[model samples]
Target: MIDGERDLIREMARLTHSPLGHAELVYPWGQGVLSGVSGPRKWQREVLEAIGEHLTGSATRHRPCRIARASGHGIGKSALIAMVVKWALDTCVDTRIILTANTESQLLTKTGPEIAKWANLSITSDWFTATATALSSTRKGHERSWRADLVTWSTSNTEAFAGLHNMGKRIVLVFDEASGINAKVWEVALGALTDADTEIIFLAFGNPTQSTGTFRGLFGKQRDLWNTAQIDSRTVEGTNKAYLGELVATYGLDSDLVRVRVLGQFPSASSMQFIERAVVSAARTREPAPALGTDPVIFGVDCARFGDDHSTLAIRCGRDARSRPWKRWHHMDSMTLAGDIAVEAGRWKPDAIFVDAGNIGAAVIDRLRQLLPDILVSEVWFGSTRVREANWNAGGSGGTRIRVANKRAEMWTNMRHWLESGCIPDHQGLEDDLTGPEYGFDAEQAVMLEKKDHMKARGLASPDDGDALACTFAEPVQPRAVPGWLDPERYGRQRGGSEEGGLYRDLGNG
Candidate 1:
């Protein structure tokens, strides 16, 4: 390493000497190591200066200010912040660095341990001891005060935010991993920034998740608030893939925790409850084999009515190694008891009938069991009771007698895989459900949820056909044999009525 690189590492080492407080920060890095010069690089130096500049410039009244940064992952952002915190603590007297994250556990698991480790290794002074200053609230249900005692580590909350009220005096409130902060939390932090001399350094880092929310709101003019560096997975300059392999050996790659903790990127949640998208898309591509009834069939049922949501039936005739949903028949209906299912069940004559034992479904299920008594009946359940319910209370479930539906979320995931992979022949199923503003991935919980509590509130109560179609992906399937005496022709589209009746053609008589 060059003299400058060595000097930079020495500087980083020296930050451990800083005085600990409520608003001071100490983060010093060896330019070569921190920024990637020969032994490291200049990027670190530039980033540090940029931060210094932003702080000075934003301090309009020399008032402590706020800085927000939204950047992608893996550019050594966390290391940089630690170094800065170290620097601030070493130089400023009683400097308080109020560090906060989405939760105290996250701050502990993600930031605290690492900072403590670094200090342990670098500090020559006998000053730092780590313990929780805040963990529980008072018996009266007020904010906890444990943080009031600890100098180096403290619980972070709106109350701890009193640190931000020191005006004219220099203070720094650092928000670690700001992506998880919601609007409510944002306001709490805002309220605490009552100090003019308090430097508001909002350092946030996260990967892309949605087009809306906090990170999206900070995209353009405010990006400079953060250095917003993104380090891609190519070889970092000084090493080849194998050399990089050596580094990986020192770090735990198997720990998905490391990805977010060390680099600030959201890791894959590892979902396994549903069929993957490739399976759904592949199933869509499959043509009904003439051999299905002879072999056995797996059915997909979607029982949404046509007015607002669709009713769909997806019939798959095989298992995973060769599973395929050969057909998806969907439509919207103004009337609930349209007799379409009894007619189709007759034609499809599935090895089993997989129906959503949900809203308006009991009548349909009863109708099918009455007509196709010889065929096995399986009522598949999906969604909440507020939205729909399968009356499993009617009987118990055992091997294939009938099965409760798997989580609708798992089913939706499987469906997403199909749509994005381009393997599915028709995206119509996903299209109808997600195309509307009603669907959105929740920002806080990191899952999809209804955007509006009362969708279609202004209008008449309408069934969601998209839900019906989606249910097909998650619906329980089974195979059933046709009655020994039944004919495929007899299953023609007709609600059970006199064969030569007073039926309307639109009701399926035509």
Candidate 2:
């Protein structure tokens, strides 16, 4: 190598011990002024220190260096991430780096360009060639081994993250806008950390836009597993003070948006989450209390039409609801599911059975009618108009008036009300499904439940259990009374002074 190449390699080796060394060498930071751009913010220096410790000073070998940062707008998170990427490439030989963002547009438009801009200004700029998806080392000996690739990940295609093993070499993985990346991608990325001796660094930087998932968990359940940081824009120098003031004025300092954008805090509730976990937990713990003066025995069915999704059956008797687990049958015929429902309805003798008739549900309804001639079966199409007369008033002079965008929305709203006032069997799947979808208001200002497609895109499984429970609200039904001839006391005696046992038997314990 020539004298210049030799000097470059020497400096790179010296900077390997500290990210601060690499940053000082590349940027012209003299006195208090930063040349070319504004000086590095305090938060940026802190991030560099954390990365430096993980890369070189970490005492343990078993745990890889994991840094998760949640920051507000204009905190220069992207610029800091770019600096780390360049530092890793220059300091570590034979290194492999992968950069990703929440979406392809974000990766291409924002993250990719920011990295390229910084790479152009670095002292060793001539050593690499920047492309749209990759930055390749142009040096004679390290052309192939030293490079960083930008890979956009998605739920449908995860192959980009597979087979990322670089034992005995440095590996840097950076996730920008990390909150929007699905949990599945995070799981896939874990496979890359298998190399025991690899100098590995995992950096996740994003705004606290999502309250649930891997990014949020870093500050919660997985706090001990990561070196976490929260950077508020207002605390940092060079941020737009006017913009921050306007936001605080419009949405209050304590609002969710302000908490996320200014205070660098996760919202108390997820932006789109419809139901709260605390409410669900309370419902599960409370004792069963059926509604007075009403039988209120209702059955709800959500049919499965495609791929791994389950056909679920939920039964509610007054305020007490049976725990109905979702059942999946691969390529099962419609008539078979109908037969199963018919048997359940016959035993429970529900006041009403509401079946979601959007897809293959019509066939199930037909077969159900044939099997139980006296059954009160209703075909409920979710896309149909929401029946306004079915609105339920929980209590008080002005109850939580439920008005939804469509039938599906109305049913879900009713299900939420049920969870608040009634009792449900303790089940994890049911809880997850119940709290899955987020809600919004349509043009008409009615509550609109998010589409299933959106939920699937976010790596959430089909909420069949929740949907089945919601179907029970398709229409209101008065409880069927016992025959006038049968004495109330005698009927109670036959059922052991309570009808709960018979109710359980009617719904089938399973």
Candidate 3:
């Protein structure tokens, strides 16, 4: 690399390490003085130089440039974006740069004033109309307001950026704190890039999140079009020792932010999860061939009827020096009720099979029994028993741990534990179902609003999926489940008949 290129990278890293000022912003093309571009702090300087480098780069002269920055909170994100806007307006005439955030109030309240504070219009006017909020330039008719040539909104809302005409001019569309926007809004914001004559420069900044969908994919894709950088919390450790202390102290040494923004990595996404997503995600890779007797030797059966439910069977080895615990699942809701699950279950010769005794489980269980009576197919039935579930108080300040009674609560909990640990180590179907964020523990509690609903409810939404998954891996607790008002044999017959259980049995419906 040339010394100039090396200097730019060094200066960029240096600026990133400390504060920035307008005067400190030196372009290789020409270093000139600007109005209020000087930032008085470390992060400020970093941001200014970053924006300056782009403003002066070839990307600005013709093609658009995209920069994705993942920054820590209070890292002067809003301040830098404003200065970047000023740098753009002064150098690039008729530049229609847009400033956007998660909200509009932020635009007017935060980004707007930052520009107004630094934008020093040429005082060509020899006289000023004090009564009217207008200043006449000495060059007369050349009077310009001390205002920003920028627009901002709280949302990556499409409408806010709509009606934009690039007109062969480069467009600087800045998406600040993009993680706050929804998927649809993000799509709309990105669509603004497709304008003709508009060399769409997509600039986005946000804290890292593992669950971020498309942004993650773009940055992850092996390409040269995008430049990405991460400003970690540790960058401010020496300066903001207090905040750093609290983070390290309050969150312990294993801080999520350390793994996230500091490392420029996506942290584990799931809540209530025992193991990390990174560990689970890595397990998806193909491992080398296992020595003899290393491949899986057991299958788990968590079966369900067709239509509106999931019928899953997972296989795990007794010992896996050769393979990771893998799970495979099939959604019965996507199909119809049939004896196909039973046939498939018999072929595996699993060490043990756990089946839930609700609805079609009984018939499937019975059929599997008919096929391989000797195979240890453990039948899990439910009775009203106490189960542990976390209950939160009204204020949302904190929560309480308590036990509530539920039919298959224990089974669900254990299944989650096993899946989380990658112990169900062979079936991809179970792995996928368990990995999905949609399972809920249906305890027999009749208290407050549902606590463990889906993400909205802070609970998994695919409990049915979890059911098929857990049942496939569950160790049976009860001999049988017999809801009141039904004969044992009749109950089994009725459950076997319907995909969704019988009219008489009011088991865990959801």
Candidate 4:
């Protein structure tokens, strides 16, 4: 190595012994390029102090040190993360660092770019090369050993986190926007903390948007293990006080929205409302899918055995889904309900029908088969083992696979994804039912939906409409051509010798 680079490394070693030393040496304060730049805030300094102390004391210990921060908007969480990353890279040689966020866009647009910008401004910028997903030492022997990786967490490829092992060296794991991260990712990440005689630092930072998750557990069940801090923007220096006051006034101090966006507080209770009201409302008012008539129409049926529950049928044409107006049946015999379903199937000629096969649903299915044997109907059991086969990608030639806890969880997650992107009609019953069920995890940390009894205890009716809609995601179905009534121009212009003409002729004969 060159004399200047060696001297720089020696200087960094001395400076990293304390957080303030590292900050003072690396930051370009009152100098060329970035003149008059200030260091971390008081709260951020506290976090750095804890990290420095932990590294000094745990030079020989096996246990990992964890620091997690929950903060409101614009408190500079990303900046603090950038500082810690530079400190680790400059101070320690052959350190392995993994940085991940909830999504790829967040990492690409914000977290990863900020780190690169700060790293470029450092005195030892020549020592490392910054790429899109990683930063690595450019020196000969140290090229592979010293690097920091940036990634977005996904259910697949979690094994990328399992390969990090730096014995007797430093290991740093940073998670940004951690609230939405799955529990499985957190579980697998624990394996990376097992190297003995290594300095380990795990930092998780995000807004407290989710009330239940590993992030929330940092302030709840797992509080004893983490050195945690909550930073409200209003209290921090240089924050917009007027905007904060307006937010508090607009949302009120007690609203969940205010607590998350202003106060840096976890929601007061578990999120009983699975889908947000605003998101649902916006989707309800959005335009219907253009392919509504040109794609397959699938039917989702939820059967009711007793009580005040209603057996309902939900129809989804491509991304456009709505429950039939007269699909709800109360205290109807299985034969009668099956006959009604057969009539609808004959009239609509849906591509595929998914029926809940739990409890009395099997009897209803048996009755339906006796009435219409040729109808394409599939039985779904919510509590059965999830159907985890490869799904055919219509756009591509291969099949893609996904993992889920069970049928119910898989369908609900699918429904949630659809709600975020697709349109739903404005129906009062559908809105209430969609927002009712809360999510929880099972003992093995698998995703689980709240039971009907749980919803009833919370004074919400059984989510029959929601359940019927969720059933459409049970398994992949074959797509068919458009029906005549839904294809307005084709039926209106071509009046003779086509499928549209045949449909009208049959209706007139009937």
Candidate 5:
């Protein structure tokens, strides 16, 4: 080797425990690949400094250096990941680094390319060979031992993560888009931390897309075990301020979209959760507006199919869902539930009654139709794939509509939208029912809710009450015209409606 090259290697080795120093000294800023770029951003510098501190302490302790960062989009996380990978491999001899992401595409297309870019820009670039899937030392005997591999994590195939052991040397594990990584992968990777007297650095970086996951736990339950940071895109320099402003204006500052994409905050619900707990809590405490006397009163009935499930009846009048208390019955036959629904319909004189037409619900709907011939009793199949044209505007871009997978998804989405201004009774069971089901996108990218069976398998009860409430949104209901003889001021009192005067009297008294 040349004398200058040997001097460069010795200088890099001196910065073994100083990641921040290594990053600043090794990379060429404002030249070649990094033209016009000055240095690391403020947050990146802080993270690198934290890593340096952790490594300094590793000499005295056996604990792994755990660092997790949850940040908004477009804040240059890929660049930071590349710097860390380069620093770990270049300074420490026989260092083994495992780089993985939420998906193979992210690892190959985004992260892998970024690492190569930075490695090529580094002063010690000639010491290593970079490839699409791996980077290895070019030294004659250290090719296999001193390396970093880009691995695509899989729940079923966790051998790569399980075999991450390098005794008496450095082991750096990086998880990009960590929020979307499976919990099983995280568990399997923990096995690598048992190598005592070794320098272990574990880094996780991702947008906080999910509320319930290993990533969330790193900031919450397991926070003491790690050094964590949440970086808002707005606070960091070089982010597109105009685009972020547009997002806040479009989705509102507190919306989940803004919270996840701009503020680096976990959503009020999981990313897969259709309804957020914050929205539900707000609805429960909100004061309902006075229902117009002409507003239609609707009844939604969800019949129980199994012995464990409960039959539920939910009543709503315009914004006043809390005016009437919900009715629930366990171990009720379809015939008996139908009879009870018929009696409620007769007493309340609901403008429309929507009944679930799945399994035993079909029998209940049949009995209700026969008993209440004059009333508008309609059958709604939960699995039906038809969505009202007006309800397709929940989420989309460029005027495109977001399609829902089935009638149940449509109803629940409609109910979620309504909760913005509507009022609901504050009940824990109803809260559980509303927030139990997680959502996913189908093959065609249509929004689909988790089936009740899936929720049960996850140890959550069937959302019968939530389904009954959502059933009210099955179809639009026109307001009923007021009688000509009744005075507007005294109409509610005469009909035994709300205390403040509205449609459908508060049924809590009854």
Candidate 6:
């Protein structure tokens, strides 16, 4: 290496614990990397300074430094992220860095390129090599050990985060666009913080688009553990002022869209989210009501129509939905799913079973009816016109009733109301499914729930589990009368099924 480069590296080693100092010194301000761009913006400078303060002294060295930044659009968050990554990798030796985003496309098209752009323009660019997925040391032996890897998080495959350990060294984990990241991934990533005597820094940056999730918790109940900041686009320099003004004019300043996309604030609930997070959270943690005993046990089966979707079976006994565990199958044939449903029906002897009659759902319903000849298995079409009574008001004070665009909307409306006092299983997937879809009104002002295709287009998973649960509310079912053979007091205990004798035969006309 040249003498100037060598001296620069030595200076960077001195600023190892000073991210702010390192950022200012390593990149040329008026040239290449930051060409025509003054320097780090005010908000960016503050974040870097905070990181430096947290790491500079030995007293706070061992403690993990967590910073959660929720910002409005066009605040140069990606640029700041790039600066941090470069500073961390160049200054700290053998620093293990992992960068992730809400989606793979974000990593590929945005975060990954941002990092490479800054790395190429840095003074020590020759020291590291940037690939499509990683930035590694140019030195042969340090290639694997000293590097930063861009990873895509998955709920099912969290092994990448679970194994994040760099003992006696520095470990930096950054989550870009973190609001969309699943709670399970965040939980798995927490295991990395246990490394003793290591310099740990966890950074989460994103638009506050979600009302509930690990990202939201970083500012809510978990705020004490993190240094959180919310940046409004209007307050930040270089933001599009006219565009922001237009947004405020189009959708009132207090609207959810403006709150999330412009004000860097969490919405009361997601604009399109039919069921609010607070309501779902309450239901998940609620205790079963004593009056639930009289409520009918209903089963909802939603058959998967596509390869990526899941076939789910949800069971609810009145307001108590926690007693029975949900069953989900991926890529399973209709016959197999029907057989499974039949088995659950034989086990629970539900008062009624509502199955989605879309696509291959009809075949599942057919097989289920044949399997449980005596049971009441009903087919429900999601696109069919509303058959139930309209309970919601269509704005204004006229008391005009609101009509649901289809049967799916009607069922979801019922489920949303039921959630206020219902008890449900505490599961993240179920929570995501319930809160995934957005709602809108049609030309006639009829309530229209976002279709599965639209939800997927917005990067949300298909609400299969949610739909199954909603199916349980398709129509009201009368509570089964206590049989003379069975004691009324032991009804709750015997609800699952009878092994000694056939309960299906005994429960007549269910």
Clash count, candidate 1: 52
lDDT of candidate 6 over 193-308, digit per residue (tens): 99999999999999998886679879977999999999999999889999999999999989989999999999879766788877888988999887534467889988885678
Please tell me which model should have the higher TM-score, number 2 or number 4. Answer: 2
- What's the TM-score of each model vs. the native? 0.39, 0.72, 0.53, 0.56, 0.61, 0.62
TM-score of 2: 0.72
Model 4 regions lying over 4 Å from their true place: 1-3, 31-36, 58-61, 269-510
Tens-place lDDT digits, model 1, residues 1-510 = 325545644644443222221112222234322343322124445555555665546435353334444333444445555555545543433445566665567676756655554444333212334444322222243233211122222224346454445444435556665555554455555665565555444455444332223443455335554345543333233324454454446666644344333333333331221232233445446543344343354445556544445555554444221234333334534133425655656666655666677655666778777777877666665553222222212133521121222345444444444333223235533432333222333334223424222334312122243344445455444333433224343466564656523322222112
Badly placed stretches (over 4 Å) of model 6 are: 1-3, 32-36, 57-59, 277-386, 393-510
> For model 2, how does the per-residue alpha-carbon lDDT over 265-326 read when each residue is reduced to its tens digit?
88766867887766776877888774543365788889887786878888887777854333
- Compared with the true structure, all predictions reach lDDT values of 0.43, 0.79, 0.47, 0.77, 0.85, 0.85
What lDDT does candidate 2 reach at residue 415? 78
Better of 1 and 5 by TM-score: 5
Candidate 4 lDDT, 416-475, residue by residue in tens: 767765677678677667766787766666667788977765446899988998887777
Off by over 4 Å in 3: 1-64, 102-112, 120-158, 161-167, 209-226, 233-252, 257-275, 282-314, 317-412, 419-471, 474-510
Ranked by TM-score, top first: 2, 6, 5, 4, 3, 1
| Pairs of residues at least 3 apart in sequence or in different chains that clash in candidate 2 | 272-438
* Residue 307 displacement (Å), model 6: 26
lDDT of 5 by residue, 79-164 (tens): 99988988899888999999999989999999999999889888889988999999899999999999999999877889999999
Candidate 5 residues lying further than 4 Å off, grouped into runs, are 1-3, 58-61, 270-272, 279-436, 440-510
